[model samples]
Target chain A: MSDDIRKKVFEIIAEQAVLEVSEIAPEHSPQDLGLDSLALVESIFAIEEAFGIEVPFNANAPQQGDFDISSIAAIAAAVERLVAEQRGA
Target chain B: MRRVVITGAGTINPLGHSVSETLAAMRAGRSAIGPLEIRDAGRLSVRIGAQVRDYVAEEHFSRQQLGLYDRFTQFALLAAAEALAQSGLPFPDGRTERAGVVLGTAGGGVGTWDESYRAVYEEGRNRVHPFVVPRLMNNAAAGHVSMRWNLKGPSFSVATACASSNHAMGLAAQMIRAGQAEVMLAGGSEAMLCFGGIKAWEGLRVMSRQACRPFSADRDGMVQGEGAAVFVFEEYEHARTRGAEILAEVAGFAMTSDAADIVMPSREGAARALAGALADAGLAPEQIGYINAHGTGTAANDRTECAAVADVFGAHAGRLMISSTKSMHGHLIGGTGAVELLACIMALREGVIAPTVGYRAPDPECPLDVVPNTAREARVEAVLSNAFAFGGFNAVLALRRA
Candidate 1:
């Protein structure tokens, strides 16, 4: 389940960045991958749609969100946790 | 004080997609207002609108650009591109740093908002598009234009309902006259012909279902339109130095407020704006030969505007050739004045007066010489473009032959 979530996360970010999934490194932040504010927001939206789970991200203050977005790995782990919690509920 | 002149003009209204096409349509006295073309047309009471037909998003913008640009921003950018190309004043070296963009739009991205809201409420969707906020904001059009042209100077958007474009053009001219910017891309755009946009206006009952017959006794109400018009307002000296083809001189502009009813038209406010514009231009009433009236085709606005024109021009009102191009293009709301200014420019530059196309019978309340249903060939030295908004906001601009 976590692997599936990770793969989906990288695909979504790659789509937003207009890059191949292989090009997106797990350690790289969205900015390091040339993802603008618009791209980041779209990635978040796509993640929510794919997982059917809401990610606590605010466009006005993106860094203050509960979901960690420091790197692609962090975003993937956050989505995994949210999906697990939703399944348990 | 510096002088400002229109170096270039571009528009995409119902009449035409280009300035040249629009001019030809005006000369032929063609009506662009026709059957509505929007989603859920069967549900709307006001089905007709003057929409930009056959507009394909992919043809005008890239996929990346389409993600950020709403229909209104697209219209503005397209119009601005044409205007800039016509001006031929390339922002070379550091000249781009001092140029700016000022636009007027009442609904900005109302289409985006309406679609997103419908998704959540009507379609029972939980998530909306991520770029919805940025796309729907009122300043989106202005911001996109500034970014596209690399205009780093003063940039903003105005929302004065129907008078928005007049206020924007007037303020842009003042920026040039005050020496704040060497050049300013000024105009307005609107894309409020969507289901939600028309539904909201239907409540006001100021919509004409059939035709927009301004100043005619059988006039019912206004027909909505969606499009844009943009112009290059440059300092006269700068344009002259560049040997740019000057379109027309933006002689003067004035704005006034009634401070009365929010929805009703004010003769006092309109008259004051007309008088103030002439005074600002330092031209007597007799010097002005034509007027492009607000003429919303609504009974109240047509009557009030005519009374105000008579009050200000008096005897000259009878001699001046006054007509409403809105009769052909339909009311573009916030963007209406910018498109109507084309009529004034045509009058001054081409010596062609665009006629009010759908005139049936004139009412005594509006007794001015409305050039009815036929374009007139006349060598007018100066012209006035009037715009009156719902909140008693009035803005009038004067232009002269280059």
Candidate 2:
């Protein structure tokens, strides 16, 4: 289920943004993936709306070092964590 | 200085072809937005646009004549014909040499470009259509209007992204004021509801998957629309002499540049333009009854425009009837303000205000009362039409009852 959700999430990001998931790895931040602050907010909205899960919003979730939203792997992991939280809740 | 007034109006929008048809559609709250019918829209996430359907060049122009014109040019010719018919102004005879034509367009001949590129890149065709350059030129519409009407004076086109038509009207007004022409055919035309056009807008990242819902909290982004709206502007005396039915006076206009950013809007820039237009019209904010907003259904634009309105009108901003007709017509880009200006003229003359179609929820950031979803009846005095373009080109025009 998380993988399927991740696939959808990656599709939206791939369609909207120029960077690819493989291009940005575990080391790169989402910002480095070129999801500007605004795009990040919008992406967050799209993800939550798409997956029916709320991302755990730590004050620094957006501020973590080298957060890579460009890579499908990173986005899937983030989405997986969020989905787990929603289910745990 | 001479005065300028709208002596005639014409349109071919998603609603219909005539001015009355479009106005009726707006009053009925019927949005012209629908599924794309032009090309293979399968790849696009957003598959809707306000397309002018069944508009065939062969039906309107002869093949030989059509060879010299693009879709934009054909639309301009038809719209100008309608405007001239409404104005009951025959070609000005020898005096036609003094009449001018100014048109606004953003995409020019984007359809032609798209087809040519496909032929060369995908089909590997070595030869392109010879009409490509003439058809694709941004000034083709103006040139066609000039040729169709025998207009000779000060003919040109102005392009300032979405603000194109408002700028054209402002310039036309100035030309009339300066006695450069006795009559001017002014407005804008766009036929960019093509594959290439939509692809170009995709790069902007602001297009909504659903319909445009300007000033709505749930609004995603703008829907593309295609059409032309033209106005016959004449010196007050010339129109009166010809017994033409005057619509609304081009009372005053103002323009400003943001100089801040290419894409983002500035409240300071918008406020200055709004204030300048009011000042130019020699009217106070309280006297203005309606405003056609440049609400592009984007988060940034609506909030910025709302804040700018609040900053300028204070409490009166709430009282003023404001709506973004783009909700119904979609964003015509360069032609939007011109077509929307027609709505303003209709409101002033008929004493009714059109509503912002597709407006559902109230946006917290955009606190303005955008006459939501339903057309309202009011004795409007003056209307202001605002257009803010991509590169921070801001233009405001104040139209009053003639």
Candidate 3:
């Protein structure tokens, strides 16, 4: 189920970005996916809503580079980290 | 400072294209809203919009010209032609240098954007249409208006979201006051009723499923609408000297930003604008007779706007006739203020307040005399039209009978 969520998030990112989702490697950043700042923000919203997970990042924060070049695998790891932190895992 | 007055007005709203036809429709208590017809509105929660019908673009512009302009620009040109013709302003021949154009828009070329988006995303086309830039540009309405009428003075576009047209009108008034232009064409046009435009708004999650019910307890949210409304504004003295039929004077104007949330409205911002516009117009709150509320049918906007009016006008708030023409015309977004301002001008001059068409039960939070679903005969000296837009842009225009 969580893998499906990651795939859906990637689909949205692919919608905005010029690159295909399959072309992105797990270690590659979102810039590698050709996502600009606007696309990144939109992807964040799409991911949050798609996964029903709250990532610990401010929407308006300048620290946007913290999620630099986020691939679907990296995004899945980040969500897992956030969910684990919330669950006290 | 020179005074600014409305010398001419034209519109192509859901009600109708001509002033008489629209006024007749309003008087008959007919709602221009129905099911969406622009294509692929089947999936959206809100399928109803106040759309202009029987408008053939090819009839107005040649095929080549149509390729160069967006639907919004086409609407602007058509409405501008009507206004200029009514004003009898001789193509602005001698006053070309001193004449100008300013238009307001929310989603400049939404139809063009939708088509291009399909070409790129669905069709997998890497290259966009060459006319994409010109068709989707926000300034295209102003550019077309300038070109059509040979206006050579200061020309630009004002975009304050839904409040765009009011801001445009207010800025044009300032231009005349500043001696930058002797005559100005100002208003707004919108053509965002496309499939993608409606889908984009659906993401906001604030559209109503039923009809727009301004100030009503059952009000859910705003219905999307499209049209154009333009007004010819001349310096008060210039209009009088030219023997122009004065519609109304642009008495006062004020603009304020909430500087807060993008979607949430602020009562303080609205209240300050009301007081500021009154002060700018050199009129007392008591003297103002009618108010055309922004009244987008959103729960937050209606409540906040009601509180603002009550705060600013005190006892006068209860006594004054207030209505949301959006109830009938639907929310035209960028063009809403201009169309509503025309309604305000006519209300002040004709001494009749348009009804809030879909009003049924009044919201307890918005407990004011919203004139309630029926046009009322009353003596109106001055009228106020309030327009609040997305991202906290708020503009108000005060108009008085000539």
DockQ of each: 0.01, 0.08, 0.04
Tell me the TM-score of each prediction against the true structure: 0.81, 0.85, 0.83
- Lowest lDDT block of 10, candidate 2 chain B: B200-209
Candidate 2 regions exceeding 4 Å error are A1-89, B92-94
Candidate 3 chain A least-lDDT 10 residues = A56-65
Clash count per candidate = 0, 9, 3
Which candidate model has the greater lDDT, 1 or 2?
1
- Name the runs in model 1 displaced over 4 angstroms: A1-89, B92-94
Query: What TM-score does prediction 1 earn?
Result: 0.81
Best by lDDT: 1
Better of 1 and 3 by lDDT: 1
Q: Interface root mean square deviation of every model, in Å?
A: 18.0, 9.9, 9.5
Residues B1-402, candidate 1, lDDT per residue (tens digit)? 799999989889888899999999999999988889788999987788888988888998999898989999999999998999899977533598779999999889989989998999999999998899999998999999898888989999999999999999999999999999999999999999899999888656567878989998888888999899999999999999989999999999999999988777899999999999999998899999999999998878999999999999888899999999998889999899999999999999899999998999979999998999999999999999999998889999999889
